[model samples]
Target: MDGRAARETPVHLRLTHRGRVVFGTIGTLLTAGVLALLAALGATSASASAEQSEQSFSTVVAAPGDSLWGIAESLDPEGDPRDLVAELVTLNGMDGSGVQAGESIAVPTRYADAPGVIPAQ
Candidate 1:
């Protein structure tokens, strides 16, 4: 034998049945918690954005020949006029679609300054 002795090799790491089960359960719980947290964050941001972009109102005055249907058509020529008329009535708390000249009416902010749409204030 030489003057130097042989060095001992390190043993490989091993897990028992119980050890494997415990580690697997911990990993699964941690993964589930992370997924849940991400989902919650995503949902919160979506709702916050929706709230921030909510519709707003502006005022317009009725012209001599202007009617609910005309205003609606001017606002969105391609879209249905009835729907917009209903919205106008609802916003201004009108009993019907009738309006007098120079009467101030509330309209959605998006359609406030469109062509033929006169702003009251």
Candidate 2:
């Protein structure tokens, strides 16, 4: 029939149901891929920034009569001495909270030197 022929001609020119579904699926996959890439980049950038902000350390030898509390106070006067001492104990892998005279330990360089005091190399 003439009417049936006209309808069939337009249907053939346009996309079929299967074609539309395939195109939609492809578009969703592409969008998800782009989002995943962006998330990875963002995480990398955050990690880099964290690394940069991390404090650098220098080694210091304990003197006679030096205690962990005193050393922490001298190195980081503005910070809590208890916390600094804990960090020192952890950094040097000391079995206990005790430090021997003339023992070298790693100390965070941030605020380690007071005004007019030269930082150790």
Which candidate comes out best when scored by lDDT?
1
State in Å the error of residue 105, model 1.
1.1
lDDT agreement of model 2 with the native: 0.78
State the lDDT at 76 in candidate 2: 73
Model 1 CA lDDT for position 80: 93
lDDT of 1 by residue, 79-119 (tens): 89999899999877799999999998778777867875555
Q: Which stretches of candidate 1 lie above 4 Å from their native place? A: 1-56, 118-121
lDDT of 1 at 19: 97
**Once all C-alphas are superposed, what RMSD does model 1 give against the true structure?**
9.6
Candidate 2 regions off by >4 Å?
1-56, 112-121
